[model samples]
Target: MNRHRLRLVTFDAFGTLFRMREHPALTYQRIAQAHGLKVVSEPDRLKASFQDAYRKQGASNPVFGRLSQGSRPWWKSVVRNTLIGSGCPKADVDGALDPVFAELFDLYAQAAPYEVYPEVVPVLETLRTTVCEDKVPNGMGKGTKFWMGVVSNSDDRTEAILQSLGLAKYFDFVLTAYHFGSEKPGRGIFDEARLLARNCKAEECLHLGDDLERDYNGPKLIGWNSVLIRRNNDHPVPAGVATASSLKAAFADD
Candidate 1:
């Protein structure tokens, strides 16, 4: 097993950092009822969809796969993907989705509708303060050179969402699926983020995320240290990699 001491810490956005719009399930339930779509009606089903929605978006965007993430607007891609995934016709997907997309926008008016995890704020506060107090490789002085960034499987809009919620300025840079033009599990997004973060050695940084494959294996393959934030489930720890029960635990060793 490789033991790593990190100088910078990057993150996987969406499930790993931001609060998911937990109400999406409820919103979808309403959509199903009004549209008579044979879609999920159960609470768990709706909750599941919130995550699934992004997966669908991540998988479908051609730009994301091309590694030009954050350069394009993912919201439009999202609307298109949502409609297609919902089984709407290609052309109708655009029209019928306008209002629904608007509803999501309304919900996500400023920052995403989902609340940041209880652990997130404190963890970020710690990182901010630590950067102010500690030294690391790369002349990273306490609070100044510690480059904090996010490699998200989301659109460029996510930056605005984070900024709206007061989390963006803390990030030196953010690379999303939109930025890379594809989502993770493919490594394209990760590579692009690393480039934006300046290709610091994998060991010099720790990546925190919620997924096993995308956030773990992808970066791990390239030598970056990984910390999986297991959410909504009890997962056996991965061999050679660390797991954080909460964001705070991730900073314990730091």
Candidate 2:
């Protein structure tokens, strides 16, 4: 193991830092009900269907893959597909797509849907000043520098979302899949983050995220250390990979 003390810490946005105050299924259900779609008996079934559709759309969308297309249209497609896949008949889903998209877009773009974790600020504050080595000679001149960043597979509204939640200032920079045109578990997003951390090498950059594949394995493929945050304790930690119940445990002194 290359035990280089990490200097720059990058995080995933959604699960790692901010969490949705309510399950997305609830929102989807509310929207469907408002638009006169038949309510399903089990909300989980609808939620699963919507998630499947969203994931498939995300994978197949060339706009996200190419990073050259506008995010609004891409999200519109996903939301529309979610409605269609949620057992809404095609005619009904089409009828409600426009309004649902408009509302959902605004819902997530603002802060009402999300909440920052209690330990996020303190953990970031500690890591930004405590871990990592000194400055790397910027023309501006600095005595020492440690960086905190965000790398997420989110839409363009991420920065605004962070700002709304008041988590923007703690980061040196934020990179979203919309900006890179690629999602996690792929090398493009992580590689872009590497370029941003010009002062630090891969070994010196540690990434913390909630997903095992995207947050942990993805960065590891690019030579960076990764920490998996199992906030719910739903899964067991795999050997040799770092795991934490919360963000605070991630950087807490042993």
Candidate 3:
């Protein structure tokens, strides 16, 4: 892959740039206690409940609703169902659900739950302004320039959340599941992103993400260069796919 010809650098928001500092289930437990709702507080049990509820909620709601429709009812349902699944009585789940959801929502709205990777800022800065020394004739415009973008599977408040984390300024635009009506691993979102980066061809763009299927397969299927950033050393690197241990490593010239 020639960096000189690249015109766009797209990234997956979570894990690639930033990630939740703490599991949300732990926060749910504290919120429930504050609301005077007696519930299971075990980390394992709460995590299981949270996962189940989240999966169920996501499955049932094909499209993530927008903030105009109360900012994703599926999320609220996930919170409510999680409480019930965690041994909170149904009545308590109902009574305390609003406050619990509000607290969690606000918590997420700020940067309290997230931590940006050490190399994120510098990598983004480079990608945002990097320009090729030579011009290419593939309809990629003169002097080969690159723009920074985010194609993330997140809620409508993604821009606001990125702002709170102080990472929004680096992105030219954000394409989110809430706005696209489809999540990653789906062609529609990537298609939308391609249209957004009109100046770049599929091969001239690069997308970096943590999930192999969403970040690698999705973009590869659409002909975009994809890199998998494995922050954790545990997962096996997928065969024939570019893998990086950090954002810095991903963009480092070979």
lDDT for each of the candidates? 0.64, 0.77, 0.81
How well does each candidate superpose onto the true structure, as a TM-score? Answer: 0.71, 0.87, 0.92
What digit string (tens of lDDT, one per residue) describes model 3 on residues 194-229?
678774578878889999999999899988899989
Positional deviation of 164 in candidate 2, in angstroms?
A: 0.7
Worst 10 residues of 3 by lDDT: 63-72
Q: For model 1, what is the alpha-carbon lDDT of residue 10?
A: 80
- Write the residue-wise lDDT of candidate 2 on 1-254 in tens digits: 22225556789999999899887767877876787777563777767866886777666775343454577777777766766676678888788778887888888889999889999988767666653333343321233455678999887899999999888988889999877777898988777787787656787778899999999999998888888999998877678888888888876653
All candidates in order of TM-score, best leading:
3, 2, 1
Which candidate would rank higher by TM-score, 2 or 3?
3
CA error at residue 55 for candidate 1, angstroms: 6.0
Q: Which stretches of candidate 3 lie over 4 Å from their true place?
A: 66-70, 136-144
For every candidate in turn, the CA RMSD to the true structure comes to 5.0, 3.0, 2.2
Residue-level error in angstroms, candidate 2, position 136? 5.1
